[model samples]
Structure formats: C-alpha cells, structure tokens
Target: MDGQPGHEPDCKSFSYTSLQGGNIPESEIIVAKRKMDPKTFSQEYEASFESYQGVIFYCFNRTLSASNETVQPNDVLHIGMDFNVTKMAAVVYVRRGDQMHAVDEFVTYLIRQQ
Candidate 1:
C-alpha cells in the first residue's frame, strides 16, 4: 500500500500475514515500486485530478475509434453534453455491439447570456 496520507485504512484492510508469509505464491505478488520522488510521481500519476487519478477506463483516448468510418443511416447516435454559463461542450458517438465509437465533438463559448 502507498504511504500517502489517508491510505492507512486501505493498508490495514489487507491481510499482511497472507501477503508476507501465507500460502500466496511469490510469483503472483505484483509489487510496483516507484523510482521517482513521491511528489513528482504523484503529480504525474494523478494528472491533476485527485479523485480520478488511479482509475482506468477504456474510453479515454485522444483519437476517436470511428474517425475514419462513416456512420450508417440506421445507426443510433448518442450525444453527451455539458452546459455552463460561459461554455458548452458535447461528444457524439454511436454504439456498435458492446463498444461505443466516438465520431465527433463540439464546443462553444458564450460571451453573453440571453
């Protein structure tokens, strides 16, 4: 477990006995050690988002999967949008089978509210 603050509870929940001397195989124990300084490492790993730092998801990518493909006429298009007083943004995608393929994105800045 990490030695960072607030990680004490998580460290205590695991069975140290099993981790240290129990029936667990040495080969299966995945120990990830950091080579860099803690503060620098934390900043890069956290990517500025404290709450979602360590969580990994498949949909996070720079390039859309369906960027080169054409959306079929019958395909269902899904859009997710975020609206604020000064800014509005949206993501467009289509689902095929179990995977969601992003097609485009839109963003607009509002200078005046009506």
Candidate 2:
C-alpha cells in the first residue's frame, strides 16, 4: 500500500528502556548494546518483533492516530477502554469524514482491580 491514495500508514518508534512496560530487561538491553550504541538498541524494534510486540508496547495506542482530522461537536465520538493486569488506559477518537483522529487520551497504572 505504499504510495497508494488515502493510505496513511502509522509507524510509532519506541526506544528500549528498562522501565515498566518495557519488554526487554535491563540485562538484555545492556547485552544487546555491547555490539551497538544505546540509541541503536533503543530504536531497534525489528529484531524481536514477535517477542517484543506480543508483550504490548503499552504506549503505542496513545499517539497512534491520524492527527490531521478535526473533531466536530456533532461528529460521533469514539471512546475506547482497554486494560490488562499491569495498567489501564483510555483513548478518545473523533471521526471526521471516514478517518478517526485521536484527540485525547489518558493512562493510568494499577490496572488490576483488587
């Protein structure tokens, strides 16, 4: 679909970090960096796509939207709620024409309701 009309693809790049939601452990990241720079390791999302993405890149949903669309008050609103044991999050999208734009979002931890 490259160069196709109305084929706006979304690609979000995330650097590797040992913080929470980071699929790679600090030790692994450190080991990977032995042959590459820190910047290289952080941005290397392709090497372990199946392993890394399967774990959920928790932050991807927030900014992964078509930003050009504007939301009118009369336009239908799309609110999505998603949660797992580690975190809970919500995203708000507005449909303009046929495309949806993420106008706002919220993220919160402590997802598991105990």
Candidate 3:
C-alpha cells in the first residue's frame, strides 16, 4: 500500500445517488436519470458518441432546445444515430439539394422488454 504505480490509495469515486452527491436537486436528478440510465448517470462515465453537448452550439442568435427549423415533406432527412443496448441518441437534419439544416436531437435510455 505504500507505493503503487498508477494508483492513488486515497482517491475514491462516488455516484450522484451516493452519499457524496446528495445535495443535487430532485428535478435535475430526474432529468439526468432520464437522459441516461440509472447506472451510467450514477457512475458518471461513458464513452458516449454524444452527451449533453446540447443539440446545437455553433450558431449565433439561436437557442439550444428550441429552434424555428421545420421539415417539409419533400425534404431529404439526414439522421445520425448512436444506438446501443442501454441508450439511443440521434441528431435530425433536413437536407435540401445543397445544404443541411440542423433541426432536432433526441436521446433516450432503452427499456428492457420482458
């Protein structure tokens, strides 16, 4: 225990639901649980393709959650998805002949059917 390479004897890890993160509000906790599964939300780590990087971040005069973009019936839809057993994430875009506009993003945890 005296000396170990790549080891921190005093370092510890705790989840948000655990003793250390009790101060978090119930509303936010509920959102976090919904965005991620209980385990991933608690452990706070994942090699996710995307994680609350928000739906959009590069454009000016645009909000994150709400956008004015609308999809027409003839528009070509381009979607990017990260599908997994535990969670599913997707970004939706409407493609014109030469350009694509960001429209929506969706993420949800999968429910086991039994």
Candidate 4:
C-alpha cells in the first residue's frame, strides 16, 4: 500500500508488461531522440545573439525537464546554445526589463574546416 508518492510500483501492471513488449512506440522513440539530439543548437543561436550585443551569457547545459526552477518566478535566467557541428557551445544570462537585458555569456567551439 506504500510506495514513492508518484512512482508507486504496481505488480499487476508489470506482470503483463515485459520490457521488450512494452517498448516505446517508434514515433515516441523518434520524438525522444529528436529532443535529445542537437540539444545545444538552439542555445547556441540565442547565445550568439547575446554575444553579438556584448551581453554576458550565464547559464548553459541546463536540465530540460521541468522542476522547481521552471516554475519559480525570477528576474534572471541562464540560457544554453549549441553549434551545428557539435563543436561549439554557449551560455548566456538574460534579465527581464523594458527591452530585455543580457548580463553576460560565454562561447567555445571547435572549428571544422571542410
């Protein structure tokens, strides 16, 4: 009758659900993979914009999952960016205001010449 608040183990539910048989659907798997891949690309784009304007980027490589931070009201936040070649990354800090403010940021990436 007791288990982790949201992670209760249901023996009956598992009895008929084998790992192989209960595999995630192909479409779902693709979605999950897409979510995980090129994760930094979006961040890089935003960070680049901040850098262009001489703003400092603060946060990078942050968790995508929603948690306390995601729900909290805040005046500042960290952003992450990824390069297209898997060689660059960036982070930026942005503050809210009349026109939005970027306090600081950093960028680094490997240059692949083709």
Most TM-score-accurate candidate? 1
Ranking under lDDT, best-scoring first? 3, 2, 1, 4
- The number of the candidate with the highest lDDT is 3
- Model 3 Cα lDDT, one tens digit per residue, 15-62: 233424566667876777688654456456332333434432323345
lDDT of 2 by residue, 67-112 (tens): 7565676877798876756676777888766767787767886634
Q: Write the per-residue lDDT of candidate 4 for residues 1-114, one digit (tens) a residue.
A: 334345556622222222245454767545654764343333332222222233322333335321222213555666666564445555454544444333444567666699
* Candidate 1: worst-modelled 10 consecutive residues by lDDT: 49-58
lDDT (C-alpha, whole model) for all candidates: 0.56, 0.60, 0.61, 0.43
Superposition error at 85 for model 2 (Å): 0.9
* Model 3: ten consecutive residues of lowest lDDT: 52-61
Off by over 4 Å in 2: 1-71, 111-114
Candidate 2 achieves a global lDDT of 0.60
RMSD of 1: 9.9
Q: Write the per-residue lDDT of candidate 1 for residues 1-114, one digit (tens) a residue.
A: 555557765554422434445565545433311344344344444233234333222235465444554478988889887674467777788887788877778888677658
Instruction: Report clashes for each candidate as comma-separated counts.
Output: 0, 1, 0, 14
Clashes of 3: 0
